[model samples]
Target: MSLFTDRQLTALKRNGFVVLSDVVDDDTIEAARDAFWDGFPTDRDDYEGLTTEPERFENAWEYIEDPDPFREINDQLFPYAEALAGEGTLERPDGRIQVTPRFPTGEQTEGDERPPLHRATGHIDGYGPHFDEHYEVGYYTVMAAVYLDRVDPRGGGFTVWPGSHWYAGDYYADHHLESLVNDATLPAYEDGEWTRGEALAHQTDPLEIHGDAGTVVFWHQNLLHCGGINTSPYTRLSAIQRFVRPDAEEIKRDAYANPWKYWEGMDGVELPSAPSER
Candidate 1:
């Protein structure tokens, strides 16, 4: 049986984030990690805002959806997801079981070095259009992150902006005070205002979450987080499964659609529009 518990769930609800200690095995993480790296497009232009600090990828979802490499992760996480989310959270017929394999601090080619944003969350230089990209407080309920490799501390382990959940949720729910989760409706980019200006400034450091190979981190959507940097020599890969309750509205990911390809499903889907009801 999986080791994630009710106590941890309670903590995640209260604080908006929690780390799952000793929840996965080395072999399982490695398998998923390898598959994702193999699929990253070597030739495409990773230009549009992919240079600096990183956490989650909106455009790169397909790599993790590859069946050859990601099937096992999909199989393993379903049961674990159900357990952590209580009995009926995931609706089997239409639910999405997801994961992300990230390669931070590595060469994408023969020579050029990766850019900054590799420092701890505190050190990241701010980017403009901050609020437009993120969501309001209760958009998603649970984010299950499975670390597929050993995450050394300076190697850019996952980081979250602590105590920001209260503020983030509130800003998102109201739609007037935008600070990174400034959102749009179902078709996302078809109708939205341009977010052009300086990003919000920060005074404190983001909550740093570094862990071993088998660690699993669960978070609320309102928690501000950045994907861990692979400051270590090896690649930092993680599979993330975002679990929303049965009746919830999702922040449409249309903006992240592949620049080269298009898919109908990515336009928008619903779990029942619990946008702010959480």
Candidate 2:
């Protein structure tokens, strides 16, 4: 039986994302949260300290070398991920766990200045110049973020600009068709012009997702998104996982041409067509 409902599939196709509530059990959620907190530095009094050297605490592996701590959550979500990206095409979950903890900003009064909910702007993954030597024109079938704790409104939630994936797919189709599949002509990370400007121009309002401990959010690869700033006292924790099709490289051109190309069971869903020109 398919793990996702027809409604869920349609939402993913139309909105570029969908939330699966309570997908992870309480025991698994507790264990994952325990693992995350245990890996956090005991010497640090608050999450703010970890942000100073963000990379040090950004991944669960940095503190807990063992993958056993996160195995349950990954195993539980693997089937759904496989269903979303097609059977036999989904890659096994890598042990790496991306840990994002948003620390609270002190008291706020009416008229106090604050950063925007989506931060300055939303960005697509794998195309930014800041990626350094590891950069390449990359694409993935699906991305998932599992919430380990309850996230309140403005509590450093995962924010997304709805429909930005179509905009990005159009941008790539218009400007980087040949370069997308040819490694030799691929723009270096430093020279790459990302879709942030286009996303900003096309999508003005961003949605911040807040949910319970076991909530799972699945998103498209080209969706424009960012982590919101935390204003609540509680620290927000979540794990990120990416799934890729085995034939990703082989289907690169077609996938770039149509953002929904690799998504199975979305055949009848009507979505806005990519613009002929940007």
Candidate 3:
């Protein structure tokens, strides 16, 4: 049987997103969650806003970049992405699958403030030179957050504007495409800048999903989304993966720029901008 049901496929096509509720099952998700805590012990008093802590990635390897374990999961879930591509239709040259984990509250390090949900992360993903210019088609990157633990609204959940991908995509293809041709780029700004209300024009009803650990939230690369604030004390850790569907090459050529992407040179030298980033 296909991984995705007819209803699920239709939702993806019509709305450009879907939530595979409990698709991974409890036991499987628990295993991954246990492994996460075994790596990072959240016993301290202050554990909010510590995404950059060395210990976060110190114990466990970053799964988004980890393919050894990812291949197994992808084999089980890839059919859905393929189905969304269209029945019997092969994925484009750049099609691939990936995962992402959002850490809203982190261990209090030496220098940091209580992290506010960054808003601009919603716009440009995958390979955009500026914030909103570079665009890719055929699903270059899809954001999927596999909830490993129970995520409450205060647990640093994903905040998204539903049906915003089509609007954002069309807006860029309309207004920004010309700017790209003219060498126009994102205005110089500090990190974590929020393009407030820019995404609201595309979506009237923004969605913030907070559910059980087994719920998986998926969104398009161009979709306007963010990880909202964490009012709870528990750490919100998810196994985030980025996916591709064989259609990555074409997207790479037109939309994505390999500015900081990692690559390997001929003599074992690593180039950050090769075919893929490690």
Candidate 4:
């Protein structure tokens, strides 16, 4: 009953994120960008020889061991993530729903230097240090993506700070997510020192997110966002994917410091004031 629309659930509870257009169909995002350029070794007109290959950016099963084209794009994004983590949340038979691979990258846009938004960073999807110093309160509540190409304006989209996920869930509900793991220990919201100095010290306004090829977005696992810099000329190709909210865990004890306490679709909404309490 909740595949969103109370104005997209109040713009995902005050702009944490939302954008479910054409949910998969531009010929399945050009056959998922031809299964991400069939693991390019370069030659789609060699867009800078496949974005300066580091193994053409690795991940789609390190170049297709084929899980049936990522389970047909996770059966079109697992029913909007089981209608927003509700209906038996991914049918958990103990093994709560988890379908991986959202790979395929290529940021391409350093020749024109756009770096604004205080030099961009806005994190929070499985936290930094290359992830896993344990921090996923209730596992993975939501992150989705799926674009597969056609993002315009400044191209490298999916940026965001709009209401910076309730000021990063009110700064992890008063810091202590494993003692804010590194950045010289919470140097300004977990390492990489304050993405643009905490969005200009919390005035907030970074947005970006243009879409087309089967769009999808979703966001909000304490959204803050980043990965936007291709200052236009094209080279986006998104994929991301992550859902988790069934038998979740790994929230390393802070006695559950309310990051929207398990987001029951963000109950009534309002919440947004923690850049040191605004």
Candidate 5:
């Protein structure tokens, strides 16, 4: 059976993402959450201090040993992932899932007046400085975020700039794919900077995806996004995984030029052309 309806496919193409509500049941979500915290690092400092300095505990995957404590949840999501990316294109889920938990950074503290959305820093992954040297531009086909707990608005939700994929494709059409490989090169730094500007100028405002536990959000690889800051008292818990096409390198250039090239059901879907002014 198809995981998405006809309308969902169109939304994925136009908005660059689609959220599937309650893909995993509450029981499963609770089980996964329990297992995660059970294995969480005990050596860390006070939890409250860690909340303000999330850079210290942002990646929970590194501290956890078992790679697939959430295997049952992943099993439930596999069909949807396979449907979006063609058979044999997606990587098998083998490594540790990226456990991204945004603790309250005191954004709600008295006297600090920045809006929750303003705390988000949007950028495409795999190309920028501080990322592993092995990653490159267009390295992944789709990204999935599986929420294990309730996410309130501005409560460390996964924020995305809708339709930014098209703008990114436009920027990459003229630039060399190799430019994203080296951070020292001028193009590597400039590519994302320029694409973000074009996306914000052309597309709608960034959307903070908030929903109940078991919500699954899948997004295009080039979509500009970031993790929203947590202002509420709760810590946001989610697992992120990126799927890569088996032949990603072979068709890198073509895929970079055509934003919808690898998406299984996006063929013939009419979309707005890249802005002419850029």
Candidate 6:
């Protein structure tokens, strides 16, 4: 049975992303939020002084490793992701939580600034010219981002370049690095170099995702995205998970493999025309 509607599948195929609103219940969101708060080290006076600073942290997996209260949220959201990606697409259940607590800092006040324009922070999830020692090669198929708080413009929403994934897949394949699963080191390129430039050249409009709590965004692995700036009085919290295609192992072994080959039933689907084409 398909969990996604025809509209959703079309959105995913054409735009390279689909948003499922309120996929999780309010209870689930609150539970996860509470668990995170309880475990957070709020002892510092600085933590409460949001007016004076903003707090951001990644790799929230550590906090959940203990009693594991947040596991409930992941368990509930995983099925929706599976249905979207197709059956047998996941190799593991682990994901990460990202905490972005934005408040008016001493240098800036609430509504003082709008999020900077989307630039070419464009890169794929697992590998690219952005590859470095700190980042690992990725085997991610479909990437899911779930928002736990209301996300408004300038409130640190997720930003993405729509349809950039198609450009990236073909670009990497052209660069002769398509065979490797993880990080395939290429010549040193400037930041926001290839796809970002291509996206700009094509005048692709970057989307600043805004939604209510429990909004889930599913994006293609090759899509270029980044976390937007948080200029709101409220903090932004979200969880991200990457699922592997069923043929993850097989594709990982093939050097000439195109990542999109594993996307079930999408072989002949017509994607929306790119900006350059139109």
Candidate 6, residue 143: Cα displacement in angstroms equals: 0.9
Q: Give the backbone clash total of model 2.
A: 0
Model 2 is weakest, by summed lDDT over 10 consecutive residues, at: 181-190
lDDT of 6 by residue, 104-173 (tens): 3333334535645453244456663333543434457777888877887766677777766665555566
TM-score for each candidate, following the candidate numbering: 0.57, 0.80, 0.59, 0.31, 0.80, 0.76
Q: Which candidate number has the best lDDT? A: 5
Model 4: lDDT of residue 141: 71
Residue-level error in angstroms, candidate 6, position 117: 2.5
Error of 4 at 238 (Å): 2.5
2 or 4, greater by TM-score: 2
Which candidate achieves the best TM-score against the true structure?
Answer: 5
- Candidate 3 lDDT, 76-158, residue by residue in tens: 44444454434433333221232334453443322144344442234334433432444432335555666767777546676
Ranking of models by TM-score: 5, 2, 6, 3, 1, 4
The Cα RMSD in angstroms, rounded to one decimal, for candidate 1 relative to the true structure is 11.8
lDDT of 3: 0.47
Model 3 — which ten-residue stretch has the worst lDDT? 258-267
Supply the TM-score for candidate 3: 0.59
The lDDT values for all models are 0.47, 0.68, 0.47, 0.57, 0.69, 0.60
What shift in Å separates residue 117 of candidate 3 from its native position after superposition? 8.3
| Sequence-dependent TM-score of model 5 | 0.80
Which residue pairs clash in candidate 5?
none
Candidate 3 colliding pairs, count: 37
Give the per-residue lDDT of model 1 (tens digit) for 52-122.
42434543547654454345555555566556445675543232345443444433422234334424332
Candidate 5, backbone clash total: 0
Per-residue CA lDDT of candidate 2, range 1-278, in tens? 76888888877887799999767788888877777677667433554554444422345556654456477777777788878776777788765667666655553322245456634366666553323455445667888898889987777788887776776676667665433321121222222354321335233578889989988999988777877766665667888877877777688667866888787746677645632233
Q: How good is model 6 by TM-score?
A: 0.76
